[model samples]
Target: MVANNTGPKIQQEKATVSVMIYLYCHQNHHTPRNQLCNECHDLLNYAMARLTMCRFGEHKTTCERCPKHCYRKDYKQKIKQVMRYAGPRMIIHHPIMAFRHIYKNLLSK
Candidate 1:
């Protein structure tokens, strides 16, 4: 996986994405803990691939702030839906990651 060659930042971003997707799947699809429905699983894989091939690599900003858009329009909308549902809940379900993401965004600005 490209994650093996990436820096800590990229790995952490991957973890955050994973958590978001998990939360989304769990709530929306009524998935079991630590499991994803088929559609969500596909989305997670797609998101990971996009992140792996990210042009900015370790120095990349959050997808929302990036100058270039890498995701296809449909997948982009799907991810946006996932993020919208999962973002606020991160503070409750995964506080540390949520705060770290917020902190990283603040520093990037």
Candidate 2:
């Protein structure tokens, strides 16, 4: 994929996943450093991989509204849990990205 097409989506996914990890880890698990535990890290990597392989690339819709669900069953559930937990928190913690994400979803519909 072209960098132009992939860059923003990749960055958005990174930010979203980062927020999810922060919330999920702080509440449920203890880590030595400000880093995700192995499970969350794996989930993040899986999310990134899915973003990279997205068929729509630059023109992609939000994954939630996408017609094709690319994630496997377990990973899909995990990601949904993350997004459900982090989506509202993002407005408080990362307002700009959260607004952009919400706007994008609105436009996609």
Candidate 3:
């Protein structure tokens, strides 16, 4: 089988989502550090699957900026909540990734 070589942007997107979900789960669900609750785990898996199959592939924009809405309604809402809660905290918890994401957004505009 051939390997699917996703670019750095896709990798970063996965990492960003993972971090966001972890932060949300840790704070709101009281999940253990570096661990995810079942609900969050399921959401993360679903999100990753959606990302992997993204029509834009490596050229994909951030979900917020993307023209397409790939997620199911409930999962989309859950992820939005996670992002809303975790976005600000990202600067404190993971500054490099946070700033990179911000920089990318600026460049994309």
Candidate 4:
């Protein structure tokens, strides 16, 4: 039998179960709320951690300056677009129509 070693990122993802637990206990229970809560919480935590760890420069991007947290070389075009627009747009804005953008993106792909 082989043991599968999880990376730090995977551990962080597992840590995000807290958010799912939180949202679940909120009492607005929906059928898919479990998945939503886990994924949403994980993303919130990941995004927050990414922001907190950034070494952002005036000229350089969070992705460029802190590639570990922000860069996705495999999704080059998507990362570039997100870095250029979504990165800055998300700073002051709450997640209002962000769901629409995400739906369009994921549904299309």
Candidate 5:
């Protein structure tokens, strides 16, 4: 699916899963897919599910390991800091609360 150019430059899309898949395929090509154990499959599947991106065509998402900015439909918790940020971000959307949090955490004695 061609992505509708939403801004000045045709937004570049990338997927983390695609990268993982690429490596997975590369590695698997050497060591047949059938030989891959359940652990490997599960780990790869979960990683792919998060990093795969379809923001352009097919709307699939890619992995975050890639050096691109695509909406990752995968779990944010895959990274520790992302998980931590999401919680506080939701809990304190109010400007006043945000200010309080900043002062409390950063500037207080």
Candidate 6:
């Protein structure tokens, strides 16, 4: 199968994930918005790159639930922490994107 390029949907989801992680880091780690600490910035950059490189494209599931593992172990742990801390908060802070993410994952399953 030809690999699909990342599309707007994936881009939007990546943006939402970045925002969620940023919010979590800001609150818990006291990082500034203009400058995420090096680790968090690296994580965000890595996640965005992974999202862009994802083979499943539009059919991609939530990374946590996905059968295909993409992130390295250390990055995976960091992302898990970010998601765990910010996932629920996304419902409040980014209702539409959050609901869409949940709905997409459920449907994909």
- Each model's lDDT comes to 0.90, 0.78, 0.89, 0.39, 0.36, 0.84
Weakest 10 consecutive residues, lDDT, candidate 4? 57-66
> Which one is best on TM-score?
1
Which is the better candidate, 2 or 4, if ranked by TM-score?
2
Give the distance in Å from residue 27's predicted Cα in candidate 4 to where it truly belongs. 17
For residues 10-63, could you state the per-residue lDDT of candidate 3 as single tens digits? 888999999999999999999899999999999999988888777787878788
The CA root-mean-square deviation of candidate 4, after full C-alpha superposition on the true structure, stands at: 12.9
Q: Which residue pairs does candidate 6 place in steric collision? A: none
Estimate TM-scores for all models: 0.93, 0.83, 0.92, 0.27, 0.23, 0.88
User: Could you give me the TM-score of model 1 versus the true structure?
Assistant: 0.93
Report how far residue 59 has shifted in candidate 1, in Å: 0.5
Instruction: By lDDT, rank the candidates, best first.
Output: 1, 3, 6, 2, 4, 5
* Candidate 1 lDDT over residue span 1-109, tens digit each: 3333267888899999999999999999999989999999999999988888887888888887888998999999999999999999999999999999988888777
lDDT-superior candidate, 1 or 3: 1
Rank the candidate models, highest TM-score first.
Answer: 1, 3, 6, 2, 4, 5
RMSD to truth, every model = 2.3, 2.7, 2.4, 12.9, 14.6, 2.0
Off by over 4 Å in 3: 1-5
Candidate 1 lDDT at 97 equals: 98
lDDT of 5 by residue, 47-81 (tens): 44333322433332222232344433343333333
Q: Largest lDDT belongs to which candidate? A: 1
For residues 1-109, could you state the per-residue lDDT of candidate 2 as single tens digits? 4433357766676666677667776656776546788898898788877777777777778887899998999999998887887788888877887898899889889
Question: Higher lDDT: candidate 2 or 4?
Answer: 2
Which is the winner by lDDT between candidate 3 and candidate 5? 3
Question: Over 4 Å off in model 1, which ranges?
Answer: 1-5
What are the runs in model 5 whose C-alpha is more than 4 Å off? 1-35, 52-109
